[model samples]
Target chain A: MRNELDQQLASAASEAQAAAQTLDGSAVAPSRNEPDTAHPSASVSPQAPAEERPRHRCVELGRAVVITSGKGGVGKTTVTANLGTALADAGKRVVVVDADVGLRNLDVVMGLENRIRKHSLDVIEGHASLDEALVRDRVRKMLALLPAAQNRDKDEIAPEAMRALVAELQERFDFVLIDCPAGIEQGFRNAVAGAQEAIIVTTPEVSAVRDADRVAGLLSGAIAPKLILNRIRPQLVKRGSMLNVDDVLDILRLELIGVVPDDKDVIVATNRGAPVVDIAGSETGAAFRRIAARMLGEALPIPALSDRSPWFARMFASLPFGKRSSTRGS
Target chain B: MMDANVFVVTSGKGGVGKTTTTANIGAALAKLGKQVVLVDADIGLRNLDLVLGLEKRIVYDVVDVIEGRCQPRQALIKDKRIAGLYLLPAAQTKEKESVSESQMEHMTHALAGQFDAVLIDCPAGIEHGFRNAIAGASQAVVVTMPEVAAIRDADRILGMLGSRRARVLINRIRPEMVKSGDMLSVDDVREILGREILGIVPDDEEIIDATNRGQPVVLDGARRLGAVYSTIGRRLLGEDIPYVELPNDGLWLQLRKMMAGLR
Candidate 1:
């Protein structure tokens, strides 16, 4: 069974490599799982032995954090694109991985859709080197993307393959943010396998929260999953119709890392092939930047979002329920 | 003459009414005097059993049948309220990997041979569960809401359907929102998807109540949504039917659709 899957992935990878060569005319190594010595940067080749590479450049292993929401269309891909951009803007080497095979959206959301010549399947199946598969951001020098295959399903890559791939990526980038596909199935399992920490994204809807609660319960391992409440309409919360941050926290019982309000600019920015984080004066963009800073160990205050509420309500929200040790591990 | 007896109801995004569509369509087909069996292929996150009010009666699920713990007939749960309707529930505790594509194929083939229609409720995302669900089916019912993200996911799903007969079912459309241009209209969805729309269900609150009561909206007497699902079933059975008019389909929108059709 394993050999059949490996063979299928190998053939798919070669097809991708051929497509990439046709598109870019870059001289790619025709051999499987071998170092691309034809490239100018052979020293930095991902297939190079550890002793030949410069070890002093990476001070510490990068953090592999999986951004997942159990429910679909709840802004998991959007959060991943914006957060990775924010981290790259803060001078951190970040690689956002689209782990949603067959439904890959991270590439399009980050406007790197056309640049994907090779994908995660190619690297995992050893048809392309890790360096060959990584797509650099158009403007950001530090941010990169490891896009998923649009043709293959999630079961094509195993959890062990994903864990090893993330470990290899950790040696190069400062952060590896995996954009997990929705659902609590093999796709979810594969995305969470490589991460030491997780960021659970959810909206205030009952279905999204229910799925989030189920996912939080699933991630009961060493990783204490943090929450990023996205698309909160404060007006609905004030009207007692929608669940507020406190209500979601009460149900999820997770540490709150970021609270982003609903902004139409996010939609406009996404459809334009640019993340909201890169847009000027976007409140959602500012929220992502703050979350990135907080991820980097900054003790930024979590915004309560309900600014129109009375001062006493905001005070009570901040006392115990708002933020929970967000600055612990950097 | 087993011509496309199995249909997999799927949407790339979750909570977009895949299970609800499967249950209602199965019930509607059964009500049409056809032997219909609804298979919940979601595995670990099974909801079709609950939607059909057959949760307590599930002794053997799809996983049990595929894994050879029980025969396919032994695992089938017959609905007491509706004659000729049955359910093959998914295992609540087993992950999707417990059932492989070939196993699902054999199970679905066996079930399809005995029933007039086999409606599979596919799990969200195009992964192991999706592959397993679509393996035994000859047709797919792609469900989606009128939202941008849902439409995008549905478009992706359409791309992945690959030679399997597929149709789009737009669910949970609010006519007022479509009139006010707050939501995508049926014409907008039809244009974006560029596929044959099987049916369009209005945004109804009573469907939720009916679902909470462990009954499909098709079984509820007072809701027009049930008739829409029945119309969808008739269309699936190769009937020429006009799309149901929504509660308030504005004349201007109809004129716009007419103009678009001309173009």
Candidate 2:
């Protein structure tokens, strides 16, 4: 019975959501700032003027970026944090929203836990204004955050609200990146709420790649997502212990974002309450910077996550140079 | 009293009788002289107490203990009728957001050290709630109904659990429907999920009525439902219970629904 019930519900939910097309901020999302007194999950915060509903109004105030994974623990959050930080560092106002509700680790990873006295739930319920809900990062004129609710089911937050919130954030921020949760469920729904494009974060493992393939299927009806291969161990790839970048790309078939090589600095920075991007001069930090630039339509091809300088590549590079000297000596 | 042995009752999809399975399995295990704690990890929608007919007795919920609003012992709602069966009810007031993954890990770690079996009613989504329910769990029982959507979700969740390394249990099959080919067979579901099936709970109407009265179906000693739940509990205790055959109910219901819709 539940099997029948879930099948019916899943198809209906997806269809209903699809038929509605895109839920626009001004049209569909009732400026939730209105005084709502009924549902506690409704609105308890003060009202915002109609003008405050959609925050930014620049020419391209509508870019939506969703960070996703086909597999878990591939550092999707790390990419969202670092890449979003890099974008903001370049002076574009950014807001990173964690759509992984109930299991919210984004705040700690972003070092914004202390700043998250207010979260996205507060904004949705009207307990707090959007401005109050946004936790600002120090990336200067750049980044803000809408933390996931630690105490609620993300499914309870309608996709309608997600669209409205995204449109609203787009009006205010130069870029809005949704840090999607692992597993395609209500969390994924809430994460992809209003975003148009997605960036899939995957690793060299088969399981991770398989999961990304599933995510790409879901994303096909919308925008084709980009790929960021995280935690690439160059030595392992060199030793043929892991799948290389091209191997993963071949399976996923999505556009490639910058590849983030596996580095202990990522974990080190996560521990220090700053993303790898915050640590200037780190290799991952630079990669993230290039990725951010690419999102903004730059012509830079950030190298795939590889250290071909290992035996094969280094030997290959040395062959040309060594051959020139050997020929002269001979 | 909590004991060393424990297993969580969970499923990939929502409303696939997770709370129903948790309530009955917990009650059955406790009936067998083992101390049990039924912790509803469907935090915001805590209904294990309701399903077990202990709702009126719940004074504190899981969040109270986790948030330190009350002592861990205080938040535990004990059911003396079942001897060692107790329930750590989910806090209806606290949203899922407030409970951190780290906190849930610590909570389950402590429970595993104390309980014989910690039956966690995992929520519908594979968000934080599912992960929280699986933390510190030695084994998992993934309950799924014989339907395509549930099976699909179950397969996806099985893959996820595979990544995290958790066992699964298939649940709630109407033998007649499956036999009539109106629903997926146990074999079909098993093939898709590809996880160990702990039990195949028959479509027991006794469960609905029992739940209506806030009692577990297994508490009724006469019915086959009790045996089914007990068989699952015994299986959890490492007993190999043979799978029972569900009689084929010809596809009358499906034909009727289609005709009704056409009319």
Candidate 3:
């Protein structure tokens, strides 16, 4: 019975994608100066090439970072979606790649599920060119998505194929954020193959932290991975129930990139397939923006979302030797 | 003689008690006079050895057998308490890419020839490790919590299993929460997943205590926790046993029904 269902699903997924305007640039050719006919209504001025645009900070041409977590359901996709939006909102060209084949969630999270005409597997299998497979975001032209096929296995894309794909993406975007699948397997290796940096996301739990530690060890020799502690409830930490940021950092010993508080607004945003970072007044949105600033080399101070420290702690901070948590910058 | 049964226990989301279910079910089947071998297919993050309390006894692991460093039987660690139970531990220092699906299939086939039942503990995620774990098994025992995220992943895995005679085992169900409508009911989970029920195991602190001591609850001789898993084992053996009644089902359920009637 399931075989019939599986085959039906596979056949539906294998249907040919609708034709999209071929991108103006390719991996080998530097033709980004040409305006993209794809997004005729994009807000950004098509005449200004992203590479030649002036910025407050002279950001690197292309930065590829894979956001990964060893444990499943710990908000890797959420972080990738929001952080990419935040970066693109900051005037950086960002392309978020959903590298989790067969379980693609970034498209749904980013509210671009219907806009996905082609995916990374199509590029790898030679069914679509790199330019033809790209899906540009409607609201933010600077933000684009490279979705993963829903019916294929992770092993279908080899590490070399992934490296080439990421390299091609790196040429066009200022920030290439790859949404890595959970577990340190073929999917992980493929996601990390072309990336120069990694962001390990984990929740404030023993099991999630332990898995993060294992992933940290694996990534030690290649890249010094940064940490993003997600779903932290300050009330639980203040009540001595959940693990504090310091406790998690003390265990994993990785540099903290971002600490996102548990916010109900995130659920609402996700349900609508919109990124929380794009929603106004969302604490998780603010957190992702801060993380994006830090990624852009801004030494922004990470404020404690809801810190109600004791009197002595405040007094200690006033004493020159002790520093307040809010004063600490990454 | 009937064919040797090979069951791969999997959950798409981590920390959903796939390892615990694998340990308990393998021990329960072993206690039923069947020669059972539990294979830990999670290569890098191996925990079945620690869960079975056989970490010290594992001189050779599954990777070692696949890489030709040791014979298949040489890597099988015998259980101290159960006579017919064995374990093939995963290598702690290796990665998941170390073994291919064909290698895993060959190893499990060899073990099936010698054992009456072979149960594999699969890693989380539908990646290479998940593919390798299911490659060797004829049947799948998918473990999941009654949460939305876990159920969604389990549904994806069930879809991928593609008619391999799969069954769902809902673990860590809190009956009080279910009664209070704070959690999904067993019927809700069954309807959402649309799979055959192996059994439902309640949230019990005793299971945690047993796990910490490297003791499976099924071997404890206790009635509540042990019986829950052993009944699933009996069901696996093709016996028609009724599902275990949760602790609060007697009076609490009757009270709830009476309250609904009053309303």
DockQ of each: 0.20, 0.02, 0.20
Docking outcome class, model 3: incorrect
lDDT tens per residue, model 3, A1-330: 312211221222111111001111111122232224544332123333334322222223478899988877678988998888777666556789998887787887778888888899999988977666677776666678899998888889899999898887775566889999878888888999989999999987545665788888878899989999998888766754455676566567789999999875665576567888767778888888889878866687876544333432332233221123343322
Roughly what TM-score does model 3 have, to 2 decimal places? 0.70
Q: Compared with the real two-chain complex, what DockQ does model 3 have?
A: 0.20
Query: In candidate 2, what are the lDDT values of residues A66-140, reduced to their tens digit?
Result: 998734456877788887776655444567888876556667778888778788888887888777777776433
Best by TM-score: 1
RMSD, candidate 3, Å: 10.9
lDDT of 1 by residue, A292-316 (tens): 8788776889977443323223322
The numbered model that scores best in lDDT is 1
lDDT of 2 at A151: 65
Better of 1 and 2 by DockQ: 1
Task: Fill in the DockQ of model 2.
Answer: 0.02
Better-scoring candidate (TM-score), 1 or 2: 1
Each model's TM-score for chain A is 0.77, 0.74, 0.76
The 0-to-1 C-alpha lDDT of every candidate, in the order given, reads: 0.76, 0.65, 0.74
Candidate 2 - CAPRI tier? incorrect
